[model samples]
Target: MSEIRFDLVTGKMVIIAVERAKRPHDFAIAHQEKKGSKDCPFCPRNENMTPPSLVEIKDGQGKWLVRGFTNKFAALNTEVKEIDVPSLYRGEYGYGVAEVIVESPYHDVTFGNLTLEQMKRVFHAIIERYRSIVKDEKIKYVQVFKNFGPRGGASLEHGHWQVIAIPFIPELVNREVEGTQEYIKKERKCPYCEIIEYEREAGVRLIGENEKFVAIAPYASQYPYESWIIPKEHQEKFEEIDEDSLSKFVEILKPLIEKYEKEFEMPPYNIVLHTLPPRDIRNYHWHIEIAPRLTIAAGFELGTGVHINPVSPELAASILKLQNL
Candidate 1:
């Protein structure tokens, strides 16, 4: 029974990796496939099922290549009345925007099958939504994520991503911000930037890189084959990546995603984009984390917030590197 501990010491999120009882293969979970209607509402032609487009990238005929619209069953409704919080225990109405990004018109198209151009459009659409949401004075954070395959939390089979603009910073983001602040005060350096420089020098856990970005399996990977995509430069906001660097980012991202698909037989995965708080971009650095759904959280991990990854990041990097070979 191994126990891993993560603590904040002098503003750094220090992770103590310990030997766990389970082996790597112990993390694997049985996968189940979902059967559904071919006429899923998220499919291009069935756009009527969703709310009218907040924004759409259109073709010459005005048919959409990709579209953004509000989710009908939104978890946070923007129309709700706001409440004022008093003291340590604050209560506020859930007033936020939840929008869906429909990736393509093709009913059966998956992200893995999308062309580079298509993927670029998806990335652009996400940026566009983020920019629009941040303009709302009430909104504080914009979260963009994809739930691929059934296991990763996608209720629909159609290739789509979700964006939620919340009135408050999420707890995870709050923790990260506090952690970064502490690290800066203690070491006069950004923890993420330091990790980036260290990873680049060591090269053992690196998966891929281009002029502007690098993808690496972190020194303490929480899951087998987990990887993070970070800007080589310390930029706090994803929107700040200029058009040239954005193109480079797209170039680097596609091949790595393809590599993951090939290596794990198109394993189910969750992709999360973490950025600085809307107003605090100067102090934070943005990154993307891709965690493959290769393992399930058993009792030990769930109860203790510790992960037991069988494959070390060095091995995962090697496997990812082989895709080019």
Candidate 2:
């Protein structure tokens, strides 16, 4: 069976082709220990290999469990204090803040395998670092993301999250923000909040929920096993999320990632945190989007901007929820 689904925020269309599930192993990666081998710079005792730490989590003996520092080969250089390019060319200096948060001291640990306390510490470091960067009025948007495995565009094998603060909001983020505002203007409520309610009532696409967050496979999911973790209450900014809320969010997230790894045989994936842009909290809601790189995009998808998802979000959620993780 096949059907069309539209993303609530962007209204982008996707074709869910259920027949593709027959080739489940097509998305699996071969076992590769080299991806998490030793001698990595992000590992413990190699702190000097990268830049100095902006934030670090330590124990009673002062050994670090997690650390955050400026990215060595940053995409946007922090040297430029402000935009300096000529207006005639319609360009600006690559003025931004790029940072890396090493999530675990161990070389082999992934998000699915990390202890609960360790995960909480990593998030605390992220929240604290986020607070520090947004204070700088020059930065307009902060992008938080994680790239896992070779197919996920990770240069290093280490488990880490990258945080980049830019001078301008990205096109996709802008569209989503606008969409949310439009929805609010007409419906008098947050679109995501409405989605949470809708998914719960539908039940088939709702994987799990706790006191603070809900995990759902979006109606128009663009990738196989894609999941979105959204807060139950309306929260506009990631930095404003308290420790209790973050703790509950992680509780649901850890098991969800574990389920993905077990079901897909360690598939490559990316995690992106989308939140309200700096100083604009009312019009948008914060959420975490996880996209597994199970399929490649070709001409039709690129040309039309319509994704062909082989599995429906409902079926994906059913499989994940049935797992004993």
Candidate 3:
């Protein structure tokens, strides 16, 4: 059966077509693992391979558990002075920040295998880096994202996350801010908060929840088996999360990743943390989106701005909930 679902934040539509799952190559069988580790820049003993660390989390012996550094090949550089341009047509100097956070000292260890303590360190390191980057008034938004496996857009196989600071708000984030404001104006309530309550009450799309966080398969998922983890209380920025909430966030996230590992054999996936701009905190809710690269978007999706999800959020949530950690 096929059904259409609309994204509340972006107003984009997606078609849920279960029958399409029968098509060949609809889902991936296994997550590709990196073969060579000796020459990996992120591996231990390769400190000289990358730029000096901005911040490093260490053990008692001072060995790094997590490290953040400037990307060697930065897409944007703070060193570049801002260019002066006219209003009619504008272009700026590549003035921004690019950083890479190595999640583990070991080459092969990933988020799926990280212990609670290690995960905490990683999260804290991310918060530290983000806070540091946003201190510069020129940096408006900091995007924290992870790419795992080849299909997930990782040229190197080491487990790492990237934080890129841009001078302006992204288009998608702007859409979300505008859409949330519109929804609040019409409904007199936060749309995401309402969604949390509705999904919790419905239970069909709800995966699970902890004291502070909830995991759910969103109604209009853009990708197969796509899932989201959000705080129960409305929050506009990830940096505002307290220690307790951070712990609870990781508690829920762990099992969600385990479910993906078990069901899809540790498939390639991306974790994107969506937050309001550091200065702009109104009419938005922060969330973590896990999009598995199980299927590729072809011409139809690119041409029409529509997605074809082969699995329904209800069924996907049920499957994820049933899996044992």
List CA RMSD, all candidates. Answer: 8.9, 9.6, 9.3
For model 1, what is the error of residue 46's alpha carbon versus the real structure, in angstroms, after optimal superposition? 0.9
| TM-score of candidate 2 versus the correct structure, residues matched by position | 0.86
Q: Whole-model Cα lDDT per candidate?
A: 0.79, 0.83, 0.83
Which number leads on TM-score? 3
Which clashing pairs does model 3 show?
none
Candidate 1 C-alpha error for residue 284, in Å: 0.9
Candidate 3 Cα outliers beyond 4 Å, as residue runs: 1-34, 82-89, 322-325
Show where candidate 2 strays beyond 4 Å: 1-38, 81-89, 322-325
| Cα-based lDDT at residue 196, candidate 2 | 99
TM-score of 3: 0.86
Candidate 1 runs further than 4 Å off: 1-37, 82-91, 322-325
- Model 3 lDDT per residue over 130-185, tens place: 99899998887889999887888776788899998877777788888899999999
Better TM-score candidate (2, 3): 3
lDDT of 2 by residue, 8-125 (tens): 5665644343344455564343223245445577988778888899998999999998999998867676655344434433344566788999998888788899988898998899
Q: lDDT per residue, candidate 1, 12-80, as tens digits? A: 222122234747664343133334545578766677778999878888898889898998757676675
